[model samples]
Target: MGPRFFGYRDRVQDELVREGHQVECVDDRPSETVWFKSLAKISYHFTDRIILHYAEDLAERIAKEDYNMVLYLGGMSFCFTHRQFSLIRKSSNARFVAYLWDAFVNCKRFGQCRDLFDDIYSFEVKDCERYDLKLRPLFYSNTYRSIPLGSEGYFDYDACFIGSVHQYTKFKTVSSIVKELEAQGYRVFKYYFMPSRVAELWCKLTHRCYRGQVFQYESLNTTQVVEVYTRSKAVIDSPQNGQNGLTMRTLETLGARRKLITANEDVMHYDFAQYGDVLVWNSDSDGISGFMRSPYECPPESVLDSYSIKTFVQTLLGEAPPYRGYHNDDCCNETEDAS
Candidate 1:
């Protein structure tokens, strides 16, 4: 697996090891040269070459190891071709499984190698229906659970938002919500992050919404994120356009026992939302203040346990049952999704 923005690859590996299984992780895009990394960001052809080489090396290594299963995370289409997948399959008796945390539109390359896996799972319901894969929601790492829930009236801020600026729409929505909250005398903590200065500069130049906005260059570690969540009464989530799956932040907020203010209405269908812990908002909506003031209703322990990392890994490996709360009859007609 490649290095995810939040070190999920490392966390997943750690969980597998804790479950008494030996694990070896190979970087999907392995390289030491700075120039290659820079060029790969701009050139798909160059990145494909790097991925092909890495796949060849990994195939050889897998042939030598007595592995029982090979789990391919998000980067399968970006990393392997049909030929390379065939070579790896021929070289190993291990079961191949894939789990996509992104939508099909974002990682459409998964289509090319879909049949190579014994089983496939996706976080997006649309992707599951379109690709005939199992539907799974993202998980909250144990780190979020470690955060002690603050007592009522002791929160440092009324609300908080800590996420990368992925698009102008998300940036604008978050800004508006923060502005509205602050205007109402609510102290809101905002941590807007951009991956690099170049990306920040490019967005500012291209989008008017980003022109005067400040963004953090480095991302917060899990500890820092948990700290921010711990200090706040609620977390704001602005999902990307066309995304239907719940984001890692949404799950983390639940794990931390914080109220959620989200743009995604699909959350209302979930079992946890039945108690009014989540507030669905839009640019024109009201009642945000009331929702923020409302006492947070904790979901059942079973509901929280269903979305934990342990359950996530177990379900992925077929050692435990998948969470059934994700599926609902009303979910099919929903126009918006989260994350």
Candidate 2:
């Protein structure tokens, strides 16, 4: 699950693998999908019999290894299911943990796997307080950014939405709104589905809806996605209530020195929105879209530059304790009383 799935397992797992851990991933790849081209099509759910076979195989393989920690980075619903977590717990002594993106959005798996985890790792501090169980806070792998262009380029677009067609009403609604926004002279970009290069080439040949005037569907690799972020004036981010709240793109937007107009409620808890830097942008709920003519102005250059990966990673790793760095132009220092 690379650029297709938002906040994928690749870069994060690569970090682990680079750290010299023998990491084996039951990743977003299908059990049988060994080749890259195999991931080009739609998803196929694993049958129970197949899943059990894999589970037993996984259990046996893991049992042989000497791992002290088992981290579930939002892939727990698949890799470490309730049944498998239990099976592994019974057979393995590894500390099982999950890093959930959406602890509250639309929660069904909470009860099933709550006890299975030794700890739930997350970035949103408020969510930890909201949950019934006491969970330890691990700086979620969100303090990273991808700017489409590294240097200055005024390839201006109003906003861009870089995500796939998810099976959620709110997400669909957001897509529609983005299209409407584009229709009104605001350039927007997103994928109809998590598009593959092969599919993209097909669309270009067909002259289908992929080439819509207002909305541009780009199948750029993760690198191009960041360039889109940097080139565009802003990125339209929508936070799914409990699931993966405070969309990672929001942080990325800051990192790219781009503005973010997000309807995500959890983002309000962040200094990004609370401070003058990021806007409390809810087109549907906030009523700001009702009368608000133009989008909130982008923050100054150094404003978001300050919220860079360098500082974010440093702050998260305890290299530098969480210190509120105030920015007068579009930043959280105004919202939070920092001494």
Best by the TM-score measure: 1
lDDT of 1 at 237: 92
TM-score of 1: 0.92
Q: List where candidate 2 sits over 4 angstroms from the true fold.
A: 1-7, 28-46, 79-83, 103-110, 123-127, 130-153, 166-219, 241-244, 284-339
Each prediction's TM-score versus the true structure: 0.92, 0.62
lDDT scores in order: 0.79, 0.51
Worst 10 residues of 2 by lDDT: 134-143
lDDT tens digits, residues 196-280, model 1? Answer: 8988998888888787777898788888888889999999998887886888899999899899988887787677888788988
Expressed as tens digits, the lDDT of each residue in 16-111 for candidate 2 is: 565565666654222544342343222223344554566677677778888776665653334334685566666678877655555644334444
Worst 10 residues of 1 by lDDT: 330-339
lDDT of 2 at 172: 51
